[model samples]
Structures are given as C-alpha cells and as structure tokens.
Target: MDSLILNILTPVAIFLFIALFTLFAVYAERKIAGFVQDRLGPMETGKYGLLQTFADILKLLQKEFISPSASDKILFALAPILIFVAVFVGYSVIPWGPNLIPSNTHTGLFFIMAVVSIDAIGILMAGWGSNNKYSLLGSIRAIAQMISYELPVGLSLIAAVMITQTLNLNEIAFNQGLLSSKEIYFLGFWKVNEIGGIFGWNIFQAPHLMVSYAIFFIASLAECNRAPFDIPEAESELIGGFHTEYGGIRFAFLFLAEYAMMFLVAMLGVVIFLGAWNSPLPNIGPAKLADWTTGPVWGVFWTLIKSLFIVAVQIWIRWTLPRFRADQLMTLCWKILIPLAFVCMAISGLWRILIMI
Candidate 1:
C-alpha cells in the first residue's frame, strides 16, 4: 500500500513539474525569439503572455479535425498520442534530486537511452502511416538523422559511465560528487571542486568529460529533432515532419511530446554529468547543509535549476542556428560526431586502465 501510494504520488508530482516547466519553456522560447528578433512575443494573453501555451492548447483543441483525404484515418489520429507517450515514459528514470528519483532502475541509464533513441521508430510510423508525401520524406530524414547521431551520443556517454563505473543514475550522481569531492589541481588555477554527488554535474570531472558534454548536447539536439537539426520537420520543406497531417488535440500532443523530451534530455544530462542535483560552488549550497537537508530536496532543486538552464539553452540554440539540410545533417553525424565519440571512448578506456594500474 505504501509503495503503491509512493509510486502514484511520485508520478503525479513529476507530471505536474514537467507540465509547469514545459509551459514556461514554451513562453520563454517565444519571448526569447521575440527579443532576439527585436520584437514583442506575447503581450496580451497574460503577464508577458505567460498563458500563451494554455491559450494555444485551447485553441488547438477547438480547431478543425481535418486530416489529409489520403491519410490513414486511424494512424493519423493515433500517432501524436503514441509519440507523446514515448517521450513521457522517458521521464520516469530521470532523478530530480538526491534520492528524489521516481523509478530507479538498475539499468536506468540504458533504459533512458533506449527509450529516447527508439522514439525514431514512432516518427517512422507516424510519417509513413500518414500517407502524405512530405510526411514520408520527413520521417525518412528523421530516422536517418536519429540513426547517425545515436552512435556518437551513446559512445560519448560510455566515456562518463566508464569513469563513474556504474549504470544506476543515483550511483552516477554519487560518482560525480565523489569526483567533485577532490579537485585535480590543473595548472594551479583550474579547480574542479567536488560538491557532493550530482551537484558536481559531469562537465567538470575530466578533460574528456567536457568534450563528451559538447558531443552529448549536440547529438541530443539532433535526437530530439530540434533545430538547426529539425530538418525532419522543416515547415517550409517537410510541412510538419511526420506529423504533417495531424490536427486539433492530436497535433498538440506532438508539440507536448517534443518539449517533454527536450526536458528529459536536459534532466538526463544533469544527472549524468551535472552532479545529479549538486550545487556548483564549493560547499556554498545545500550540499553543504546537514545530511537531512542535503538529501533529496536540495538535490532535486539543484537538478531542476540545472535542467531548466539546459532547456533554455536548447531553446536558445534553436533560435540561433538555421536548419540543416538532411544530407548535411547526416554527414555531420557520421563524418564527425561518430569518429570523435569513437576516439573519446578509446581515451576513456585508456584512462580507466591507467587508473586501475
């Protein structure tokens, strides 16, 4: 009974958190775009159009239910929901705080990558099921992009997991904090201090860790089908990617899933490299608090803050970089990211062997 209640409560808590953050992300993305382009984003809905996404959802729900005449009625209707659920489940294994994790699987890292990576299959289904030409082309492009990028992303993560020597997300946190607990004195000026566990994040751990961070972030952007990598759904070219024929609440589900996955990747990044939920400074945050406060809540708070920052950065990158051509996208992944990740993995293996020696 107690475990049941905890499980129920945990999901509700996380769902609410993801919902609110996503709403904020939607508004912020628009606002940032407006600011960057020297124009107003949403001035009428609520405070700075804070209610813009809510308004958009309501509007979408009320919009026409029209699908293409040639579209597969059942799949056109189901694809958005399917895609949404795929991204939503990816959130389960992510730890928000110290022990504030929802579902802590032994193979948490593998579980996350697997779930997120396979979402490309859903894209393929959605695009092909739609029976629309642009939808088909976009889905094909997305699958190719996902396939090419997943290699580098997975390999880059191998570097971190090798260093930490664990598959558990919380254990990954502990590993990072352990690294943060003792900073290697690099040239007497660079002090990568240990915070606790997740607080140290991952980027500060080693020279290669930073490279992994860059590699992971870029590959993540592609994996999520975000811009400049959003070529799969280029509005001008692909109409809407695999979702070109979706409408009303169905289309909204696609939008929701995209943002949710973005947040999930951010959270995963936080846990793997950003110290689960540890603060950045040396003993300045709750990680320095007594064991009680330093436990889950502080970790959760820091983790959210770190994740929010990453999401915002993702949004920023979207507005800054232009979309890539499908060919250009595939080339970047195979010709560049994959080889770099290969080298990173080799270096990670060598580093571990030396440490053991």
Candidate 2:
C-alpha cells in the first residue's frame, strides 16, 4: 500500500512541480529578454507582472480549440500530449537526491537518453498532421537537427558511464559524492582523507571528462532546440515551426514540453557533471549537517539551484547569439561536435584505465 501510494503520488507531484517551474521559466525568459533590451516586461500584470504567466494560462485556456480543415485531426491532437509524456518519462529516472528517484532503474541514464529522443517523433507527428508545408519543413529540420546532435549527446553520456561503469544515475551521483569525500593525489602516493568537496565534481574530475562535458553542453543546446540552433522554430524561417498549426491548449502543451525538456537536460547535466544534489560547499567530511544538506529533501533544493543556473545560461545564449544557419548547424554537428565527442570518449576511456591501474 505504501509503495503504491508512493508510485502514484510521486509522479503527480513531479508533474505539478514541472508545471509550476515552467510558468516561472516563461516569466523569467520574458523578464530577461526585457532586461537584455532595456525594457520592462509584464509591468501591467501583477507586481511587475508576477501574475502574467497565470493570466496567459487563463487566456490560453479560454481560447477555442481550432484545427485546420486539411489537418489530420487524430494525429494533430495526439502530438502535444505525446511530446509532454515523453519528457515526463525521461524525468522519472533522475536522482533529485538520495532515495528521491521515482524509478531507480539500472539503465536509468540509458532510459533517459532513449525516451527523450522519442520527442522528435512527436514533432514529426505535429508537422505531418498539420498539413502545412511550413510546419512539415520545420518538423523535418527539427528531426534532422535533433538526430544529428543525438550522436554527441549519447557519446558524452557514454563517456561518463565508462568512468562510472554503470547506467544508473543515482549510482553515478553517489559515485561523485564518494569521489568528493577524499583527496587522492599522485596516483595514491599521498592521500588526504575527507578533505576535498566541490573539487570532486565530474566537471572537474578529469581533463577528458571536461572535454566530454563541453561536447554534451553544446549538444544539449541543440537537443532542446534553443537559440542559435533553433532552426526548426526560427521565427524568421518557420514562424512557429512544428507547432505552427497548434494553438490554445495544444500550443500550451508544446510550450510546456519545451521548457520541461530544458529542465530535464539541465537536471541530467547536474547529475552527470555537477555532482547531483551534493552541496558545492565543503563540509567536515561525513558530518550530519553535510548529509542534511546533501540528503534527499535538500538534494531537491540543490538540484533546483544547479538546474536553474544552467537554464539561465541557456536563456542568456538565446538572447545573445543569432540563430545558426541550417547548413552551419549540420556542419557543426557532423564536422565538429561528433568528431570531438568521439575523441573525448576515447580519451576518457584511456584516462579511466590509467586511473584504475
């Protein structure tokens, strides 16, 4: 009975959290855009537009659902829901903190990489079902970009897995914490026990993993279809891309899914490179206060902070950089990031072997 309730309630709670965060992210994006352009955003809503997102939600809710006469009604309606569902499934395996994961599968990382990529299918569905040339072109572009970038993304993750020798995200995070607990030096020529803290993060773990992280971060930007690489939804090009034909609640679902994907990638990056829920501050090793801060509930707190920081970087990039030309986008993936990821993965493997020896 307890397990059953936990199983049901956890997912519900996660969805609620995602919804709330998505609202805040929208507001933040607008406010940041305003800041970048030296304008006030949402000043007319509620308290500098605090209530703006909610108002927008209400307005979207009241808008009538409209589909074009030529559209495939069934597939068009299903696409948004599928997109959102794929993100939710991908979010399930994340280790927000100790014992906090909903599904602690052995193949947690693999599951995430696999399921998240399936969202491209939803985009394809939205495009084809809309029966619009623009939408179809946008969807095709999105799929191509996503599929191209998935190579580096997967390779970077596999590099991390090679070091950890496990597919479980929780185990990866746990390994980071363990790695954090001590300072090893000169191939164990000298060891300082329970001294190192923030230095233990995978981002700082080794040179090759750092290279892997760089590849992963860039690949993730493309995966989330954010700026610079947002060729599919480039307003100048595809208007609204695959969701061009969607509006009202369906558009809202697509919007929600995009932000959710942002959060998902950010959280996954934290788990893989930033030490999951581990505090950046060093504590007297193995102390109760450390556990309190790094443990399950507080783990969620740290994870949120780290994830939001990554989201902020993404937003900053969105505002700062121009969209990549389609050819440049493909060239970047195929010519640069893919080869770099392969080299990093090979080096990461070699580094792991040397460390183990």
Q: For candidate 1, write residues 1-357 as lDDT tens digits.
A: 999999898878877777777677889999999987899999998877888899987898899888777877777777777777778888788777656677877898998888876687778878978898899999998888888888888999998888777788866775455333334322123443433332345565556777888899999999898999998889987678788788787777787888888988888887887667765545546555433335566677777788889998998899988888767887898898888888888877886677422
Clashing pairs in 2: none
lDDT of each: 0.77, 0.85
Candidate 2 local lDDT, residue 11 = 93
lDDT of 2 by residue, 117-143 (tens): 889999999999999989999999999
Per-residue error (Å), model 2, residue 192: 6.8
lDDT of 1: 0.77
Index of the highest-TM-score prediction: 2
